[model samples]
Target: MLSLIYARSLDYCIGKAGQVPWHLPDEFAHFKRTTRHHVVIMGRRTYEDHDTLLPDRVNIVVTTALAYRAAEGVLLAHSFEEALALARGADREIFVVGGVRLFERSFPLAQRVYETVVHTTVPDGDTFVPRFDFSGFRQEILERHPTDSRHAFSFEVSSYERVE
Candidate 1:
């Protein structure tokens, strides 16, 4: 199955430019534990921003550039289809993590979404999660937490499963 995973602020902003503000240690831990042997697909920009490829998982970086060299532990693809093809026979879930463009391109193929909704607004942002019509999915709020006074924010961990 394919899943889309992200942590977004209350205003629905996933990132300012290309950075996610909240430090999601719990979320990362969950991802690492659950998808240890799975494939994780992301945009080239996301890979660049992260600077290093993740170990113990197949890192697929998607880009449209004619030519580029992949870093260690990264497999490069020019499109979402190509990325999926590379992981076609994998037995574990394929997770699509972001940068917005990659998210949009991969959303339709997602069978589920694991989202951490931060309960605060970020006044300035250049990136967003695409609006999705949830008619075909079932949503469950898994957990919620209030931000410490220093950060002045709160958030919920929600999961969405496709109805079919």
Candidate 2:
């Protein structure tokens, strides 16, 4: 199964100028726990912004540049379809880790969405996870944490499963 995992603010903002808008250790830890053993597909920008490949997962980068080459152990694809094809037959869920473009294209292809919704907003954010209509999916709140010194905003880890 392909699951799109991400964190977004209440305004649907996911990034600001190529970086996550805030520092939230708890959310980062949650993301690590959820996607550690899975395949992660990201766009070229996301791959570049991360600087290093996430440890313990097969990292797949979708890029259109012919001359693009990533670090060792990272697979590169020219399209979202190709990325998914490369991940085919994996026993575990493949996570569509993002940049806005990747998520926009892969959202329809995902069976599940694991989203952490922050209780704040980023007015200057240029990146976003597209607004979704949750009618076709059953939503569940998996985890919720209040704001603390380490976590600026309260957030909820919500999962949406496509209703069969």
- Candidate achieving the largest TM-score: 2
Against the true structure, candidate 2 reaches a TM-score of 0.95
Q: Which stretches of candidate 2 lie over 4 Å from their true place?
A: 89-91
Candidate 2, after superposition: displacement of residue 37 in Å? 1.2
TM-score of each: 0.88, 0.95
lDDT (Cα, tens digit) per residue for candidate 1, span 1-164: 99988877777788776677666666556657666788998888778777687888988888898687778768888988888888776666799988787788878888899887877778897678887666799999987776665445667887899896
In Å, residue 48's CA in model 2 sits off its true spot by 1.4
lDDT of 2 at 7: 95
- What does candidate 2's lDDT look like per residue over 1-164, in tens digits? 98899999999999888889989999999999999988999988888887687899989999999789888898989998888888885666799989887888888878999999999999999998999777899999998899988887999999999996
**lDDT of predicted model 1:** 0.79
Which runs of model 1 end up more than 4 angstroms from their true locations?
Answer: 149-152
* lDDT at position 137, candidate 1: 90
CA error at residue 18 for candidate 1, angstroms: 2.4
* RMSD per model, one decimal: 2.1, 1.2
